[model samples]
Target: MNTMLGFLLIMKAEIIRGWIITRRYWFRTLTGLIIGYGMLMILIAGFFYSQPAIEKGINQLDDPTRATNYILGFIIGLFAFGVIGMFTQGIQGMAQTGVLEQLCMSPYGLVTNFLARAVVASVTTIFYSALMVYFVVISVGGKLYFDPLPVIVLLTLSFINLLGFGFMVGGLVLVFKQVGQLTIIVRMALFALAIFAREEFLQQGWLVSALMHALPITDASICLKYVLVKGQISETGQFMSVFLHPCFYWLCASCLIWTFIGISLFKIMENYSRYKGTLGIY
Candidate 1:
């Protein structure tokens, strides 16, 4: 089908996006290897490192809450680096390499193209979170037996939520430290939770609690915590809906809104540049 073909093309272009950045830096081969495996090792180590604290909190609790919180904290914590984590350098790399312009000029399927780019990097977040658990097991440490299905579903939901944010930030990169800063801090906070979060972290602080509810991530992260921690298998569908159903549709809507804005801006800038005969000046 034509629709299927379009999807394949989008995936093809996005899968190779990192190579473009590496080529621009003349570090294609070297950086590829580093990003490829170095990222995995760090993810493994982070998960491993955070397990003790997860278990520590678990031990202090009476029964199931201990296991529940540890699992919730551990999984949701890694959410810090989820798809949003790829932006750590992916955003900068794309902008610096002038890929923003290139992306806007695609032949067709702009949303699919951009989503592919976002998903490609989002893999790093998944890597780090899974490794955390793997390393803990290898070290002969306290390990929580998590049901993989829920975690996978939660991870998928979180990644879809971030795809929208990535698109909106594209045009603002020229002068947008505030958004970038906020992103970094949120990433750190989430990663911290992935390691271990206390009730004090989730319940007591008014500011933190407020932010938790307000951020897009709070939806899935909480869903993950509840399903994993509370043993609420029945709530899984609702939690998945809260984040995946509406969030993805919103993300898709955002992509359309953002791409429209981006195109409008480009046209305006192009016309102005043509009048001045300085198109490449930017």
Candidate 2:
């Protein structure tokens, strides 16, 4: 109970610190919001505008509703990427700023503080995602089929998998002090998994489809697109359908497995860094 209370306090402090930073640089904040979100909206518009061929392809599926599914998937994926990247880059930033050494010596421990900051950051991402979605839907003249409960549930699961990925990155940063190349590869892989998996051409073969479905964030993206753009609510009263679905189950299993791997690897790297007396080294 005491530990939980302390964690909550730290989380609150972190959130306040974030608000202070944002407020102190309100212009930068506004500029970042405009540029980042504007770029996303513009790119999405460009994709659909330039590629009427894709629309024709979806029309071939006899599902006219899919006209906007890819765009929506990209939006959701971008949101997820932002949330996960915030955590990963926060850890990396600590290293770059020589804060990791102090954090290592703190009573709260590096992992605890990192997780707390990440949770706080992720809480705000929900609002960011909603605002982006609202603007995109309005601007694109697209309809949304929002089932709040399922969307929340699935998105949370997806982020759990991402949290594990963040842990891995954090671990690497602890040991290597720099992983620019690895980071790029991981980020692009995530982008592909989340954004490109929606392509029907990739659905060929049992093995290929299974692999795509099992990829982290892919299934969640599909289901989220279904709920947000297609109006298909599998169930709200019962949780069984969400769990029974292949994508959903894959998400759960992958979260469990990857989280275990991530934490274990991070712990190992943290200990090694400490043993080497380089925990503070950049």
Candidate 3:
């Protein structure tokens, strides 16, 4: 009970720290929101409008409901990016600033520290993503599914899966000290797969489809799109069906396995760093 209380306190402190940082940079935060979301909306809207072939292939863009899928897919994509950034780059930032060693020395542990910060960052990311998605949908004259329950369910599942990937990246950063190029490749590749992967192909038992599913967030993205756009609850169905569905079930299993592997790998790296007495070195 005491340990749990201490952990909670540490997490609370980390969350408060994030709020303080954001508040201190209020102008930068506000500026990033306006410029980032505005530019993305213009780019996406213009590209689709210009590319008749792509637009036709995707179906009637003028149809608000049908367009929701495309918009929501980007939203999920942003969250996936967030998961990657919040862990890998989050750790990288600490290491560069010589904070990782101090964090590692904490009695509460580095994993808890990273996770506490991540939880707060995830909340901020979701809020920004949702805001961007809303305006982008409106810009394209697309109707958004206003239901929060399904969206929350999708986000919860996606976050779990991505958290495992984040752990893996964080572990890599712990030992390597620099993984910027690798992270970019991983992030972009995963984002592409999540945003534009063909559902029909993924349903097939092809090697490519299998590979895509092996990556975190791919299956969840499909399920999320189904829920957000097609008015479907799960890509498969409701209740037990949600659990039984290949997409959801595989995602849960992958998250559990990856998370385990990631934490174990981080422990190994942490030990190695301590042995070398290089925990503070960049």
Stretches of candidate 2 off by over 4 Å are: 49-67, 199-210, 233-244
As a whole number from 0 to 100, the lDDT of residue 108 in candidate 3 is: 70
In model 3, residue pairs whose N, Cα or C atoms come closer than 3 Å (at least 3 residues apart or on different chains), thus clashing, are none
Query: In model 1, what are the clashing residue pairs, if there are any?
Result: 43-128, 47-132, 48-132, 77-193, 77-194, 78-194
Q: Hey, what RMSD does candidate 2 come out at?
A: 3.9
Which tens-of-lDDT digit does each residue in 1-282 have in candidate 1?
A: 764576677777666765576567766655654574455445544544565686654344424444445544555555545555444344455555767446546654444555665666566445645665454333434344366776676667556554444444432332342354466676676566454533344466878865544444555555565455544433334423323433334334444554466545434544453465432223
Candidate rank order under TM-score = 3, 2, 1
User: Number of clashing pairs, model 1?
Assistant: 6
Tell me the TM-score of model 1.
Answer: 0.55
What lDDT score goes with residue 140 in model 2? Answer: 56
Off by over 4 Å in 3: 46-63, 233-245
Span of ten consecutive residues with least summed lDDT in model 1:
233-242
Write out the backbone clash pairs for model 2.
none
Q: Count the backbone clashes (under 3 Å) in each candidate.
A: 6, 0, 0
Give me the displacement of residue 65 in model 1, in angstroms.
8.8
| lDDT computed for candidate 3 | 0.73
Candidate 3 lDDT, tens digit per residue, 135-242?
A: 878777876545577667667878877887888777777777677447978888777676675468576777977787788878888777665665555435553323
Q: Candidate 2, overall lDDT?
A: 0.69
lDDT of each: 0.50, 0.69, 0.73
RMSD of each: 7.5, 3.9, 3.0
